[model samples]
Target: MLTALNNPRPAMLAVFMLLGGSVAAAASPTITVSWRDKPPYHYLDNGVPKGFLLERTQAIFAAAGIATRLAPEPQKRIWANFSHGATNYCSFSWYRLPEREAVGQYTLPISIDPPHSVLVSGAALARVKTHATLAALLADQELTLGVVDGVSYGPELDAMIAHSANQMMRRTVDTTSMMRMLSVGRASIMLVDREDWEYVHRHEPILQSTTRLDFPDMPPGLKRYIVCSRDISPLVMDKINQAITATGGAVRSSHGTEEERKAHQRP
Candidate 1:
């Protein structure tokens, strides 16, 4: 070994580091992945990726002899990197939106959630109590709706929001903040997954009195999927498809815990 005094040149050190990385990667070339923090599905647990979706996804990839490494990052960066082909990563717990599908490859359905549920404070609910359906509720312009900015609430809901964009209040953040808007009546109503609403409600006392509005006209629960960068090789995706088939399906279990179904009720 060279003595401590005999330092390597910077250029040589960089080349050596590059060679070391290549050698290490050849033995185990893991795909780096990440997704936004959407609770009860995917999120970072103590700075490490630890959701049920991660476990299920990892299991499928592992069984296919493919490994993955987590690169926790913001949601926007996930798409940006993929779009530029700067990196190859797959996002979890995504929904099938035509706009997104045009830009990336999507995996099979990850989970079938109940229809996006509308939420309103107890008092707000009473105002629209007679309006029992989505159409009727939308006709009443007195109440403003809340939504997370840039989120696609399914095609049908997206159309609805577009129709009432003037009456819609959007937050440039997660649904948790939108829920808060409903709690204080700053926003009269909001749309979210029943499971997601309940999860956030449990933690935010301001939302304790929130009620789910019944919308018979709404489509069935949204189908969650993983939208991968278009640049990902077909072989890797084919393997994932086979893994999905082998694992039965990606919607194996809810991820609030190892046994979330037993722990939380279907809302």
Candidate 2:
């Protein structure tokens, strides 16, 4: 049974009616949640939507007595759709930014943990350590860093990357592909969330031999949240936040190690 954020059945409608007077009372309000392929966060496996963040979102909405459809959309299209009010949707595990807030609302802090280190093959790890500051990191013309295309890492980082004339070479469509590229020496380093990296490392053979270069003292990780369109009612946002809070603030991994947890907890 695939979960959808659009198709509401009669039984679901009946349940909503029974719970009428709540914010979910609006005629089968189906929120088209935006999703992208970020493993251990949001991804499809054997045709089933399975990920920590996606499952947590579903659980949160269910707890709030809200029936929503979880539809997967491309990152850019999802933002565009929500911005135009063409859909009442939200995305799981998104970094909150001022530009995004102008067009959408956010659930309470999902993960305050900073992003983990960029996992690179052993050969590439040797090169990244040579660069100290971000400027030095960017100045290395020989290096090819990989970042997910639509991810935001706050304003300062965004500005820095935006101003960099040769930043395009550092971008990739998804993390898994980026990791593969790193393994094959197609790219030097792949930037990814620490928890996510471990998840992949445990499950994917290609990543098992890779080396993780943690910027423990540097700004690498991003605090993430669930975000919905600004057009969504304040009542809806409140319900979502209530559900998130009730669920203990964020998603708990079913398969994370103590080290990964500690790394995520690091400022």
Candidate 3:
């Protein structure tokens, strides 16, 4: 029961309502940016939205003369926001998906994350240290992974999980739960961004146990795109990309490496 309070995921529609007025009313052509409560990435600060991407990009968008508002939503609602009849809605950041691309538009990356790492209990790290790729890691039937429901772990990891035996243990909880599960040795694995790893360590020191294994088959980092509803024009995405680039963000190029391996891409 205590875990419920610590890891609450209130309904997305209810959360968006707490923003005082229609997100559309905040700014003309308001880019209603939706985000999950993933700390170090996106989370609420005193009922106002603030986190790495929201705090960093919102100000930049404002400086670029683009109006913005924040909405906290569950992953499903965030996807729905891009479906038909949606307004100028957009996600704060995401690894673009084919389904999302089919329904809306993706801008050049607005944030960058080091290649996702396999977080684990200390004992689990020793077991997986020699494992280079996700496929190799999952070969051990004794191991299981914790996943955030609906989250994309880039193309390579996602594909690997899909094809692997049913070894994944998914939860609707946020990043905190991923860490909590690792601490208690829930499943021995949690895939997360390095930034996410650092963020959890900073705030949950008393509960933190940071042990990570890299997936050498994947790209060196994840590129975050702002997926906008169909109502947003390419010109708007171009302007958004311009603002993003000014803040050290850019689209990922071909993955360069000195080693030969299966290619797990970002798009």
Cα miss at 175, model 3 (Å)? 2.1
**How high a TM-score does candidate 3 get?**
0.75
Candidate 2's TM-score: 0.77
Q: List candidate 3 stretches off by more than 4 Å.
A: 1-27, 130-133, 251-267
Q: Cα miss at 88, model 3 (Å)? A: 1.7
Q: lDDT score, residue 47, model 2? A: 88
> Could you say which candidate leads in TM-score?
1
Q: Which tens-of-lDDT digit does each residue in 110-141 have in candidate 1? A: 66677676787766777767776777777778
TM-score of each: 0.79, 0.77, 0.75
Question: Which of the two candidates, 2 or 3, achieves a greater TM-score against the reference?
Answer: 2
Overall local distance difference test of candidate 1: 0.72
- Model 2 segments beyond 4 Å from truth? 1-28, 130-139, 159-168, 250-267
Question: Clashing residue pairs in candidate 1, if any?
Answer: none
As a TM-score, model 1 comes out at 0.79
Q: How accurate locally is residue 228 in candidate 3, as Cα lDDT from 0 to 100?
A: 80
lDDT of 3 by residue, 1-267 (tens): 675567666544467666644454454576787788877677876887667677766866765567777778988887766765578888867887787789878877776666776677765767766666677777766677788877788887787777766377888777777788777777777777766766776777744555655665655676777788888877777778788778777533222252311322211
Clashes of 1: 0
Model 2: weakest 10-residue lDDT segment is: 163-172
